[model samples]
Target chain A: MPAVTVRDLTRRFGPFLAVDHVSFDVEQGEIFGFLGSNGAGKSTTIRMLCGLLKPSSGTATVGGIDVGRDPEGVKRRIGYMSQRFSLYELLTVEENITFFGGLYGLDDRTLAERRAFALDMAGLKGRERTLTRDLAGGWRQRLALGCAILHEPRILFLDEPTGGVDPVSRRQFWLLINRLSESGVTVFVTTHYLDEAEHCHRLALMHSGRIAALGTVSELKNVFAKRAVVEVRTASPMEAVRALDDLPSVEKTSLFGTALHVWLRPGQRATEPLRERLDGLGIHAESLEFVQPSLEDVFMDVVERAGGTAA
Target chain B: MRRLLFLIRKEFQELRRNPRMFPVIFVAPVVQLAILGYAATTDVKNVPIVVVDADRSPVSRDLIGKFEGSPYFSVVDVTSNDGDVQREIESRRAWMALTIPPGYGDAIRNRRPVTVQIVADGSDSNSAGVGLAYASSLIAEKAAEIALQRRPPGAPTIGSIEARIRVWFNPQLLSQHFMVPGVLALLLMVITTVLGAMSVVREKELGTLEQLNVTPLKRWELTVGKLLPFGVIGIIDVLLVVAVAVLWFEIPLRGSFPLLFGLSLVYLLCTLGLGLFVSTISQSQQQAMMTAVFFFMFPMIYLSGFIFPIENMPAPIRPFTYLIPLRYYLVIVRGIFLKGVGLEAFWKDALLMLGWGVGVLMLATFRSKKTLG
Candidate 1:
């Protein structure tokens, strides 16, 4: 059975539907990524799965226990780390770890063993007495993750756990996540970083309280984006994009820094015809080549199709 | 149970780390009790009086001397002119002004009732009333003595009633004995309610509460754990303030110590529940503090009959006093402190407080569960 099975799960905040008929499954030991912009119902869905929120309708079963019927049972078997660093800022690192460990009902002997393990996991082995607020942002995030998993839960739900950390720290945190996944722990996480989606074994892209895409990175890039992505580096990429916008062959236009990436309609070539059209518009192009659609391209197309802004 | 112990330990660790908690938990109650204990007195003494004697007779000097001899009245100024007495009263130099209207010894010798015109400043009505009562009683005694001395040895007494005013419980009527205990209750209410509410809402603001919500901890465990440390601190505060009341302020602990301490525990639990209720409704620490003050603490203090007597309150609002936990607490504390009353006298208050404390805790726990969801 899948580690997490959510079928037609829905949550409404008053009249506003925060999670609308959301459905997905996380296979055991796989790193599953839930991707969405802010307020796209990622946190709400994670909350429901973590047994912290009751779904308005449908079913969510974590570790074969019905979350709606037995939320406490699901709670005992999983670990959760939120976007906000929720450790006690005034408490020392060891105190936060011990407190959470005790909450998870770890015995003293087991807790002592895990305390050392958690410290090593967060790269905070010798800094046990340092107050949480005095630690750097990256260290705090890692320590929070360490606290969440101190009980050695079978499944982990991380909701934007590296939201505001530096890129280097984020990379290190992902490496930690990879190690956990390799150790046969199902890792379910949410993020806004499209690049980070590459680290997940599979991903679900959410929009407006609905999942728009669910597949591996390459599968999402292929299935949702059927058109060819052609990058054009021109003297004026904005003018190049404007010139290409009205073309019947060009399906979508997105400006990527100094280069303009244009999605050509299916069966259209990205060779002489596109270049000749741009050159005729007085838009001088430096180079034009067909490139594999980035996950950002897939996300933009998915969001645009869902009536949200592409970029 | 173990999880609760851990959570409570965490709470104390946080409180200990905060330097500001020392003054609020340990020092503030003692200082407040000491200050409000002195200021909240109803017993008035040493009222200044201005006397204008127009007669200058031996009888008039004898009456003025009697007023001077009493501890309640101090003859601050003596003048022959009535205008000086009026000026002394108008300028607030004297609390009361007495004018003898050219009274000759012949009025007393003839056994006629002579009225002495006295004006008392009514700005502070409480002190003014006490001062007037003292002056009237002293004058009545002196007049009665003179009347008896003039009467023949065989004549029957005119006044048939000879009543003795015996003030029981507090014969000396020291307001400190009553007020100091009441101040202890007031200090406990403010500190526990406001501080407890702030601590819970602070966790919400910091997002730590949400983290705990996802854990396996039960709702009651979290609620009781969150408030248990503050409850312990509140008990310590009660001990500290009561020590100051009994030892420092010299307010005797008349009744059973265990009864007072036990009732105080029940009262503190109710206040902590009130704080939790305030926090459950508020979204921030600042909002919680404000609600704890204006909504919980102020109404509880006023309706609890801490400063104002419940019987003296308006009839329509009198029934609401039964709903205030501090109302029962004040009765219990005052009964134990001054009246030296045992459990039989205040068992009803203890029962009501017990019911109110449990009801409030259950309601707060229900609301907190909803908020966590």
Candidate 2:
């Protein structure tokens, strides 16, 4: 049985369909990334799954407990860290962890032990007595995550968990998430960072409240069937783009900065022929490079396939 | 239940950390009580006066002397004419005038009654009342003195009709005796609502309410968790006010301490629940405070029988006052403190307060659940 199952879940705020008939299931210990633009039902879906919101219609079960029927029971079985740091700013780090632990109804001894464990996991153990507000933004995010996981629930939901953190902190946060996932806790996360999406074992890309695509990293790259894009650096890139537009091998050409990105057919790589053509115009190849599709490319390809609503 | 205990501990720690709130919560009430205690009083004396003795006679001079001798009136001015006295009153420089007609001392020798007229500015009715008390007493004393001195041997005198008044509860009838209880009632309303509303609003602002919303702690548990600590602070405020009333103002407390405490707890529910209710509706802390002030302050004071008797309010307004919880609370507090009344006199008020407290808390708790919906 799946650790989390959502079927035909629909949410609406008045006429706007926030999560329109989206459904997915999370396997235990899977790192499931939910990718969407801001306001694209990512946090809303997380909130519903976490039992923080009542669904407008449809049903979800987390750890075999119906979320809508007994939300508090569902809450007990799941851990959630929202994008905004929810730990009390005025309280010390130890106080926030101990407080959240006690809130989950943990016994005193267990709460103490778990507090120490979480603080160590978040790398916030020694700063236990420091006020959360006094910490930097990255530390506060770690503290919030620490508080959420203190109870060791079977499943965890992180909503854009590393939103404004620096790249280094973001990498560190994801590393911690991977360690937790290894311990057999199902991790469901949402983020705008396509790079972060690359780290997930599987991901669901949503747009305007509907799932645009759902697949593993390799599957998404496979489905991103756009041809190899060659960057031709030239002084007049738009002129180069226009010159390359009518090439027999070229599918589409657009200028990016001072380089012309030429999407050629699958059989037509950025081969000697394309380079010879660009050299024919006064635009030298300078340094030509063929690019592999990134998760960002997959995201953009899927978003474009779904009508580019994210832009 | 355990979650609620942790929340309360967290709340206390937060309160201690924010040093700014210390002066506002602890020191403000004590200082206000002392200052308001001095400014407010039921005892009235020294009403401003500009007396014009038009008739420059010995009898008139003697009457003016009698007026000045009275403690209730301070002779701020001896004006030249009635016109001058009117100008003084209109300018708000004086609040009273004593006028004596042209009379000779022989009018009293012949046993002919002479009348002296005392006029007062009625713009300030309390001052007017005090002024009236002084003038009437002066007349009564002089009339009795004359009646006794020139009485035919064995005739009845005017002194036989004297009446001695005994003011119970507050024997001195100090306004603080009345204002202090009302201040406490208002204080509870202000602090409890602010604390309750602020707790929830801060969670919403900091995005923490959503964090706790999924926790094992239930809605009702969260409700009490947010409110109980502030309720404790409110009770502490009540104790402070009681000390100020009983010790500083010398207001008599005739009822049991347990009764006061029990009533305070009941009233706290209404106030604390009101704060929570506002917090649920408000999107921010500023909105919560504005809502509390706009909706709660005046009605809590006016309808609570604090400034004016609730019964004496207009017939249309009387029924609406029952909805104001402070009205019932004031009755319980005043009845306990002043009248020394037991459950026999105060059970209905106590029950009304309890009902309001429970009703508001339940409504607020349900509203919190609906936010998710």
User: Could you tell me every candidate's TM-score relative to the true structure?
Assistant: 0.96, 0.94
RMSD to the native, candidate 1?
1.9
Candidate 2: segments with Cα more than 4 A from true spot: A235-248, A253-260, A270-285, B104-106, B156-166
What stretches of model 1 exceed 4 Å from their correct place? A224-226, B84-86, B104-106, B152-160, B370-373
Which candidate tops TM-score?
1
Q: Write the per-residue lDDT of candidate 1 for residues A43-139, one digit (tens) a residue.
A: 9999999888999999999999999998889889999999898999989999999999999999999999999999998999889999999999999
Model 2 superposed RMSD (Cα)? 2.5
Error of 2 at B78 (Å): 2.6
Interface RMSD of 2: 1.7
Model 2 residue A77 lDDT score? 84
